[model samples]
Target: MELTSGIRDFALTPDELSGFHARGYYGPFKVYEVDEMRRAWRGERLRLMDREYAVYRSEAAESGNTNIANYDRHLDSAYLADHITQRRITDRVTSVLGPDVLCWRTEFFPKYPGDEGTDWHQADTFANASGTPQILWPDGAEEFGGTITVWTAFTEANEETGCLQFIPGTHQSMFYDETKRMHYDPSSINRKEKDGVRRGFFGYDYRQLQKDPDWTPDESQAVSMVMRPGEAVMFWSTLMHASLPHAGNVPEARMGFAARYVPTSVRVYPDTEEIEEYGGRVSLERHGSVLVSGEEKYSHNRLVDRTTRGHRFVSN
Candidate 1:
C-alpha cells in the first residue's frame, strides 16, 4: 500500500545537497509525525519480537544483546519495508546516491538508560567488526565507496538518551583500515572509557581498526545530533560518527533504525555466505538487497521485491 494519498517529494535542494557534500551529512528531517511514529512503533515493537521471517536464524539471532539479531528487520516487517522506500528518505538518498540505489542492509541501534556510547568510528567496507568487506564498489568507484546511511529516530534521541555525534567532512578519508582485525569481547561493553566518555563499538573496540594506533579522535570537533521522534538523518557511512552514553536521566530508550543504501552497481556482501559479529554468526541464506529507487541493471547482487511475508516492498 502507498504510504499516503499523493506523490510526495523530499529531495534536497541544491544548497542542501551541496551542504551535505561539504559536511558529509544531512538533516534531522521529518519522516513521520511524532504521534504517528510513537503509535506505529508501539505496535511494531511487539510485532518485531515475532521474527519468524527474519533472514538470520542462528541462536545468537534470538539474543537481545547480539547485534546480529537486529539486522534487517525490514526484510520481515511490513512497516520497515515501507520505511526504506518512503519518499522522504529515498528522495533525499537518491539526491546523494544518484537515481539507481539499493538498500543493502538495515540495523537497529538502541541505547537504554546507562548504556555506553558508541565508539567514534567510520565504516568503508564495513569490515571493522567482521574483518571482511561487506560491500565492494567497482574498480573506478574510488571517488565514493561507502554506503549512505539513513538513521531514523524511533524514540527521543538527545544528549541524555545517547544521540549521535559527527565530525564534519571526515567522510572523504578513512582513518581506520577495515582490513585490520578487531577483537570482540561483549564484557567490554560499558566497561571502558575513551577520552573520559564511556564508549564501545557493540562488542569490539573500534580503535583496533584505526590506521594510526597512536592517534585519537579529537572530541573537541565533534557535534551532537539531537532529534525528536520520527526525524531522520542521512550521512556517508565513512563519516566519523558515534553516540553519547545514555545518562540515565531519562527513562525512555533511544532507538535508531539505520537503513544502508548503495548504488545498484556495487556488490552487496561480495562472496559472503554468513556474517560473524557481535559474538554471533548467522547465515545469509535469505539475504537480498531491496532496490529502493530506479531499475537495477546489475546482476552482481541478489535482489528481492516482496518481503518474506508476501508484502511487496515499495520501490520508486
Candidate 2:
C-alpha cells in the first residue's frame, strides 16, 4: 500500500512513517479501549492458565515461566490469535514491512511488584542468551537487521509497574554482540544489580553480552515509555531498550505482549529443533509462523494456517 493510495484508515502518515524510520520506534496507539481491555484481561488471564493448546508443551510452561514457555501464546489462545491479525496492528506493521509479512514470534514480558528492571541492550541476531540466532535476516540486509516488534500493553505499564524505555534511533547499530555467550543460572533471578539498578535478563545477566566490557549505556539519554492497558508500541527489536524495575508498592503487575514480525524472506529458526534459554529447554515440534498479511512467496520456514486449539488465524 503506497503512502498516497489511502489503502487503510490506520495506514501511517508520511511524517509518521519517516519518524519511525528516524527513531526506530512508533506510537503507543490505542488497539482497544481501556474498559474493554480490563474486562477482556480479567477473563483471559484465567483462561491462559489452562494451556492445553499452547505450542510449547514442556512441563516448563508455567504461569511464571520465563523464556520459551512464555513464547507464542498467540498460537493457542483464540483472543491472541485474533489479536495478532487485528488491523490496528497489522496496518501499521504492513506499512513498515511490506504487505507480505509473517508473525514469527510472540512472548509475554511481565514485571510484578519488586521485580528487577531489564538491562540496557540491543539484539541483532537475537543470539545473546540463546547461543544461536533466533531470527536470521537475508544477506542483503545483514548489516542493518532486526525484526519489527509490536508490544501491546495488556495491563497498565507505568514507571512504577516497570514501563519500557528506549534510546531513540539506537536500532541501526547494535551495542551488544549477540554471538557472545551468557551463562544462565536459575539462582540469578532478582539477585543481581547493575550500576545501582536492580536488573537481570531472565536467568542471565545481559551485561555479559555487551560489546565493550568497560562501557555502559548513557542512561541520561534514555526515555521511558508509559502506556495504558490497551495501547501498543511498534519498534525494531535491535533498538537499545530496557525497562524500569517494578517499584513494588502495589499488587498489580505490568504485562506486555510482544508480537514479532518480519518479511517472509527471513528465516524463522534455521537448523534449530529446540530452544534452550531462561534455565529451561523446550522443543519446537509445534512451532510455526503465522502469515498475518499478504502472500507467502518464500517457504524458508514452517507456516501454520490457524492456531493449534482450533482458533482460526485472521489473515489479511
Clashing pairs in 1: none
Best by TM-score: 1
Per-residue error (Å), model 2, residue 230: 0.2
Candidate 2 regions with alpha-carbon error over 4 angstroms: 1-6, 62-66, 310-316
- Write out the backbone clash pairs for model 2: none
lDDT of each: 0.88, 0.84
Instruction: Give the alpha carbon lDDT tens digit for every residue of 144-194 in model 1.
Output: 878999999999999989999999999988999889888888888889998
Model 1, which residues run further than 4 Å from truth? 1-8, 310-316
lDDT of 2 by residue, 71-177 (tens): 98888888988999888998999899888888888998989999998878787777777789988888887665888999999899998999999999888787788
lDDT of 1 at 222: 95
